[model samples]
Target: MSDIPQERRVVTAIPGPKSQELQQRRVAAVAAGVGSTLPVFTARVDRGIIEDVDGNRLIDFGSGIAVTSVGASAEAVVRRASAQLQDFTHTCFMVTPYEGYVAVAEALAELTPGDHAKKSALFNSGAEAVENAVKIARAYTKRTAVVVFDHGYHGRTNLTMGMTAKNMPYKHGFGPFAPEVYRVPVAYGYRWPTGAENAGPEAAAQAIDTITKQVGAENVAAIVIEPVLGEGGFIEPAKGFLPEIVKFANDNGIVFVADEIQSGFCRTGQWFACEDEGIVPDLITTAKGIAGGLPLAAVTGRAEIMDAAHAGGLGGTYGGNPVACAGALGAIETMKELDLNAKAKEIEATMKARLTAMQEKFAVIGDIRGRGAMIAIELVKDPATKEPHPEAAAALAKACHAEGVLVLTCGTYGNVLRFLPPLVIGQDLLNEGLDVIENAFAAL
Candidate 1:
């Protein structure tokens, strides 16, 4: 539907001369710690394709790290955000509340899980939303301890860095994290000490036991989890894991928070991934895909818990800026109009079938997991050992990039090759991208 050609066009080599030049400029200007998966500077994006500075069009498998679920150039999103931009860029919503922000809150309250009376607060990024959610949880419960799962990625801020599990890129050398944050085991099936089938009940029991003995469930303010783990290799917790956790939280006074930042907003087949098990949380944090690639995030929760915070305790200068809110409203509209949830299911089926076939052919593919469009393959050196093979993941991503497909790698061990194509991607283009990945694996 978009005027831009929907096919991958490699007129030049990956990270061609123009991108190389830009990369050099970036090295000189940008911070060293900030990295790029593909060093190709983007000139434009049309639907699921990213046209780079060198005029090569690449299929987008990473939607700006799962932010652009409605596609970058979605008509309604562009139209509404642009209209807001023309009207006014930013008046500081804190100084003068706007209709757009309230509309976004209303949309989140309706869309996020739970039927009980709910309230919503908006923020600039996933990290900010998480920080506020923690504050709100503590305020409501009058507790100090916070519990997070291993292999979970919350964000990069000081507090969230403490909550995250990865070491190298995210939490390395950054120490003296905020106090009172505790880490417990997640239902990482593939790597579970025991077999994966028992990972659900066993891991949940272990985690709950840890909380009960060490952290004391009564003193814990929040138990935050990503229903479908994102940066930690797209690990979907075992079947019985979440329900058990939710039950314990309800039994105690602890707030159960679903950090649906990366997994929310139809990135999964459902509007939110938590719906798969019907496990609703006390507070759900959402961002990334909420605002058509704009920087917007939200914390929607029960009214009693949300109201625990003072009137001015939950806002920021740029939180829910009018332009970002307009984009969010437009994104919600697009999701409904296009029925992206169904599209995500279609993607899941296609990916599961093809990747399962790949697993049959390749010994390195130890696991193929994830739900909806947020799928991944865990590579290992040996099937029996299941030793992490970050090398193969790196090589496969590079091969896909060489053929004009933009793929991404993640995981605690960096052995996960994640695919997050835009929901609006043409079936033909998505297949072509998958074909390139298949070929890349064949080469390996």
Candidate 2:
């Protein structure tokens, strides 16, 4: 159905000649801080494949870090965004309001969890959305402290950097981060010390006790977390964990925020991962897959809470650019029409089956977890010890890349091989990608 051919074709090496030249130019032109998972430069992308500069077609497993869940060039997104571009590019929403921006806000309110009266404010990035959510919570609750979980990743901005848990690349030398941001344990089932069954209650108790004793619940403005942890690893919290945390937040009058930047939209076979457990967050920050590869983010919450800020407290020059809003609307349309949520579930079933089969043969696969299209395999040196095998993870990613399949790795220990294929990916292409992964594991 899609224009892009659904196959992996390696005409040249992974980087190839043209991409190598571009990489050299990039080294001189771009900042060293900007990092790329793969060295190949993309020429075009559609549905499940990305054509590299040297004409090699690689299966897209990362989906630009889950930003293109509807595929990079969905017909709806392209048509709406193209029309919006020709009409008007930017008038600045804060200066002169636009229907597209308002429409996106209305859509978010209707789509996010909870049927209560909700309001939304748009931003340009997930970090900006999160920073604003914190501001709104602090203003409404008259408290300064914020509670986040272990291995959680919020963003890279000043305040968000404080909320993020990883250090090396995200927060190594960035010192003096915003104060009053507290950290607690997450219910990571695979690596839970006391085992999976006890992980839920034990971690929830530790977090609650820590909040009450150390931070004092009354002083905390918000308890922000990801229903399924992203960046810090695609680690889904243990069952019963989110509900207990929600109860504590409700009892303490703390704003419970769900950072669904990476796990939101139709990526997890649901509009939002929180829906999986029937947990409704007071404030939800969404980005990434929200705008069909365009930069758009939103903070949706209860009407009273969202309206707490002063009339002029929220807004940015390019916060809700009309083009991005149009893209978001189109993305939502595509999601609904194509039923990408159900597609995500199908992807999960297919990938889980293949990966589980691979696990039986590869003892290095310590854990296979995640939901829907957002899946990952944790690599370890030995199953008995469960020691992280970051090297193996890196090597496997390299192997996949060399063979013309793009994969990405994450986790605090960096031993996670994450898969975020587009929902529109063909089953044959998906199976081919899995075959490449299996061969890589077998070779190891």
Candidate 3:
């Protein structure tokens, strides 16, 4: 059905001559601040494989950091976006409104969690969506303080950087961030100071106490969080944690915001990870997979909260670009037609089973967590101590890359090997990638 071969093939060494040349060019042309997980130059990407310039077909487990959940070359996305491209590239939606943008907004209203009358504003990246969400929340609640969790990652913008928890790489040296942003502990089950069973109640109580004593719940505008933490070791908060926080927000009149940028769009088995706990956020920010592979993001939320922003208070020159909107429509169509949510569940089952089995063999796997296609394994030196093994994670990823299997590592400690294979990837190819990962662990 797909033209791209659903298999892994290594014709030359990883980052072979052509990719090496491109890396050199990238060094010259690209900013040093811009970093890439893998240096292989892509010639084509379709379904579950990324073909390099050297003709190496690597089984892709990164999905361009979970942006291609509907596959890089899904027919619907290509057909609709291509049609739009031939007509017009950009009129700047604010300058001259377009049907495509409105259509996308309507679709997001229906697709995102909650049946309440909703509205949406599009943006160019996850960070922009998050920033706008905070703006909208503050406007609606008429408050200034914003609350985020320990492992949460919102975006790279100054406001988001202040909201983000990690310091190195993201927040390092980028100081004097926005004010009124508060950080609270996340109920990370594996690394919780207390046992997993106690993580939820303990963290929730502590967070609520902190908010009450320090920020004053009355002054808090929003409680923003990722349903499943991304780029922070794919940490899934302990059970009951989200509901507790949501209850607090509801009781305190604080707008609850779900930063589903990396965990939405059917990547988490459910349409959005918040659905897992039946939490209806006042606002939800989305990107990464919203427009297939196109750069688009949106803040979809309760109509009342969304409308709190005055007319012309929110928008971007490139927000909801016609072509990107078309891609989003196509992507949503593909998601429904193909039943990608079910596929994501299947992917989760397969990945969890395999990773669990590998954990039995390799004690370095401290934890295997995440939902559906957004899975990861945290690496550690000893199971007892649970000391992060970032070096091993890096080494294993490198080995997988060398063997024509593309993987990514992420975490606060940089010790997580995250797997975000395209949902359309064949089972055989998926298993092969796992095999490569297992072999990498074995070699280590």
Q: Give the candidate number with the greatest lDDT.
A: 2
lDDT for every model? 0.93, 0.95, 0.94
Candidate that beats the other on lDDT, 1 or 2, i.e. the better one: 2
Per-prediction tally of clashes: 0, 0, 0
- Stretches of candidate 3 exceeding 4 Å from the true structure: none
lDDT tens per residue, model 2, 1-444: 237777899999889999999999999999999999998998889899999889999999999999999999998889899999999999998788989999998999999999999999999999999999999999999999999999999999989999999998999898889999999999998889989898999999999999999999999999999999989889999999999999999998999999999999999999999999999999999999998999999999999999999988999998989999999999999999999999999999999999999999999999999999999999999998899999999999999999989999999999999999998899999999999999999988
How many clashing residue pairs are found in candidate 1?
0
lDDT of 3 by residue, 1-444 (tens): 236787799999888999999999999999999999889999888899998999999999999999999999899999999999999999998899889999999999998888899999999999999999999999999999999999889999999999998898999998999999999988999998889999999999999999999999999999999999998889999999999999999999999999999999999998999999898999999999999999999999999999999989999899999999999999999999999999999999999999999999999998999999999999999999999999999999999999999899889999999999999999999999999999999999
TM-score (all chains, Cα) for each model: 0.99, 0.99, 0.99
Q: Each candidate's root-mean-square deviation in Å?
A: 1.0, 0.9, 1.0
lDDT at position 227, candidate 2: 93
Ranking by lDDT: 2, 3, 1
Over 4 Å off in model 2, which ranges?
none
Give the range of the ten consecutive residues with the poorest summed lDDT in model 1.
1-10
Give the Å shift of residue 325 in candidate 1: 0.1
